[model samples]
Target: MIRRLAAFARPFSAWLAASAALRVLHLALGIAILTVAARALAAGADAVATAGTIVVLAAAKGTAHYGEQYLGHRVAFTVLARLRTDFFDALARQAPGVLHRHRSGDLAARATADVNRVEVFYAHTIAPALAAVVVALGSAGYLAAAAHPALAVISLAGAAVSGLAVPLLGRRPVRQAARRRQETRGLIAAHVADTVGGLRDLALLGAAGRWERRLGALEERAAGDTRALAARLAIRRAANTAVLAATVSAVAVAGACLWRDGQLDRQSWWAAIAVTLAMAPALTAVEAFAGESGTTVAAARRIFEIIDVPRPRVPPPPAPAPPGPSGSAPPRPAPPARAATTGPATTTGPTIIGPTIIGPTVIGPTVTGAASPAAAERRAAAVSARGVGFAYPGSPPVLAGVDLDLPPGSTTAVLGATGSGKSSLGYLLAAVLTPTHGTITLDGADLRDLPEDLIRRRVALADQRPFVFSDTIAGNLRLADPGADEDLLWHVLETVDLAEAVRALPGRLRTRLAEHGADLSGGELQRLSLAQALLRRPALLICDEVTGQLDAATEARLLDRLRRDSAGRTTVWITHRPATLRAVDQVVVLDAGRVTTPAGPRLSRAGAARPGLSPAGSPGPASLGDTPGPRGPAG
Candidate 1:
């Protein structure tokens, strides 16, 4: 934890240095005030003279302290904000790999609860801890200047105890407290998120009351942990206070003895009192360090765990990508889809290789009846993955050994039972999950060796039960293409057959899609997901069981559009039903995580074979069963 904390702070050394300087100035002002007060008291000073000096000293010290607070907090908060940014961005980029291994609530706890704990260390603990040392040394110097050099040693000993000893004594208990708090918070988040996500399931089963009782018990455990920590915290405070009182009493007795022996003067006598008073604030400040000590440890461990997550192999930079016509290639395997290997590769000036440019256009020999323009366009082939394998962090291999190649300009259907690693295959081929054991390539080139941002613009997936932001349809699409014009946006909407529905809405392009898209029907939500995938215009499109709940007609319409728009593109559709598979060019079957042979059907020239059933005795091809039905995975 400390190592990671050091790493977070490493980038802001300048701010730390400035904060330290302010702390020194602030301490100096405080010491000056203490010295003036002691001198006035020791010299049989006049009431008015003493009052004036003390007031001026208090004002100067207070201003310095205020400046120190502002500067230290500002710098710490800025660093903390940056740390939060780094943490969140890294988590976003890292989530694809980590999600399979971790629970959503657990991750949230780390990102939010754990990161917030570091603030205490930055805002309160660090500067004062350093300032405590400076004040102790400065007080000793002040005492030495006042006639008793030995008193400086006495002050140093007390400051050292408060700065170092107190925290060390509390370390074990504090660490345990922090770990308990962190773990409890994660458990609570996990339970709550699980309950909320599966609300429909619980309600349907009449298990809602049971789940609440269960989650209530977990919440009580978390609260109990807090109570336990508070109890220990109080004990630590008592111990620290007792030691402080003892130290002060001993010092006072020593001062009196020194004065009796004539070794200490009136100045030394009064200085002792002022120095001892400073010890209380300095000692009270140490408690902050002890308190946050546990949280910092927890946060550091959480952060380190995230950083250790494995990332997909980054693809090499595209070789000075060719600037094809329109700087956009057709969705076929050779050109536009190569961009999907990483994403759409961008080129500034005219070049040789471009993502959007349609590869060499073939002119077929024309008989009296040649292929229609739409058929010929649909004939454009897209990229395919031959063999893929993957495994989550703790689980056994997800895709043990799977071999399948997706054809260009065709929708390929994949089916399997739950936990058979169906979704894992979609993510792997889409470059969202890097195969641990096998290679995945686009246009016959390895995907891991491609630039990532380029992949997002070219290859994309709409997940099962997709999330919709509380924003307009246009706002949602803008996330895919930030500069998407209203015309292009509407065209994509119409392409997905949502134009009628979108137009009927009160605000149309400006209408808000309420949170979770609760207002939209399952069919509309599925179509909306389709519209999103269309907006990307990706060379390769991955739909992971996203259409498992719509009515047959709606499903048919959506699948038909998917097939139509798939022209010049490669499409992979994960499903359990055989009906949807009938429209696609080929079908891949996964059983226990391995691919079966003889790609199901070649729907290119001929129509769907064997009605609704896939060629291999699979269920109806268009199973929208994955549409978050009664079985929401039960967490």
Candidate 2:
């Protein structure tokens, strides 16, 4: 709570101090005016001078009040704007997995509405509260010594009750209300995002009305909480108000008694009244501040929650080293072992006793020749998985005791039906997620040893459907090669057969892509992703059924170029299509997280017409481990 409030004053600490000074000046003048009029009455000074003193005090108080309010608002808005930006940046930097716990509406509340509500604290409550305490204490002390001591004590009692005691009493319930309100806002934002994202599906299925009803119910609950919070605040206000009136009345009674005792003359009587009146406002200021503290504390807690979430654990060893481009010597192939997942590829269910029979890899004889075919294949240990196994936070193992290899300058077809862990495998290779067991090596170096960004530059994956940000055709193309010259960008487009489409745009490369590439056709987006992948000049390109929906002719054309461009460049093809399987060099089959028994050309389907393998697509169920996830196609 303190940090967030202080943040509001950061941009205008000078202004805050100035506003505070003005508030003090206003209060001082107000009290001074009261003293002057009282003295004028006692001394019987000229009427003009007395009236002028009162006028000056009124004018000064008016100006100071306006200045404090104006400056306070300025600071509040400036800080709030900065806070929103910082909130977005923080959310963006969070690990993808961590976002699962929060609701969109709750985040929005803290970022937008809740933070905005705290404006009063920055602009008015804080400065006024400070000035109020100072004024109240000063007046009480002055009147007690100079006018009426008992009256001063009475004012002091009221200030304590209003400032400290009453507000503290309401803190807990108010805080909970603020917390609930914040959560509701974030939940609402998330619901909106989800509903909009699925609008088309919902409309077709006639479920939009049902969702609307659910959203209405959620809104109603929020309203109920708001009413409860407001009602509590109202009660506190009424109680504090009564306390304030009684304290002021008590001070007045004390002044009358003092006058009767001849301890306070007429001048002293008026001065005591004025001081007590000045102190009265302080109690109200204190009350207001107390009421706000609860909600602010809850809001602060929500913000800290995001900042304090534990980061994803980093595995030991290192990410694999990025390999040289297609033209360079392939690094020495080590056995399947990534330094990151250091533990033995663990299998939870019934460990294989002896002779683990890890997958076989053709580790060609070592040679010194640089140009020979054997030398060219030296870099071919593109990716090797040794005893690869993984289980989520509390779920059963999705993959267990698995070993696999994809060599350099070769096309390896990865076939799996839905839920076959195909996408999880892709994510692991991409270094988007770290494995829970075993090791993954690229070009023979442990992947855990190398920087993930650098590793991905050498290995790119294209999902079946990928997001295309709204931008000009050229702008989108430049994502992979930020510094690519115009000619190079056009060349990549031509390679992916998107050159003609791009040129046909009304604004050509300058055409706006619209929100999320709504202006582009599905095929155009796929081609653009391919162009981006090509521009990276990756050694191992992974295409995860990217052409799943393309027609035969279009698929053939894209596939033809893929094979030609991928020559001597390692490639992994994940497809269910017969044509894609025939285009690759070899096929590795997976079933139930392990190469099935009878694991040669066919698996999964029994007595089913076999799809062609390398020569002809093989027809057996491809290994299905995890769902195909939507992810970045970064090499």
List the global CA lDDT of all models.
Answer: 0.64, 0.64
Output the TM-score of candidate 2: 0.72
Candidate that scores best on TM-score: 1
Write the residue-wise lDDT of candidate 1 on 1-635 in tens digits: 66667666666666666666676676666656676677777797797987887788778777767776776677667766786777776676664776666788888877777777777777676677777677677767866776476666766676677667766765776678768778888888888888887888999999999988988888788788777778777777777777667666766677787889999876777677666665566567777676667878877787667756656553332232233553332222322222112232232111111112111221112221222243334333345554356777666677764555555654566755566677888887777777776677776767777677867756878777678999888898888888889987887777667889989998998999887898998767876887787777777888876666665565656665554445456777787654454544445555556643223333322124432233332344432233232232110
The runs of at least 3 residues in candidate 2 whose Cα sits more than 4 Å from the true structure, single-residue gaps closed, are: 1-23, 26-86, 102-110, 114-129, 280-282, 314-415, 428-465, 469-489, 530-544, 559-635
Q: Give the per-residue Cα lDDT of candidate 2 at 278.
A: 63
Worst 10 residues of 2 by lDDT: 348-357
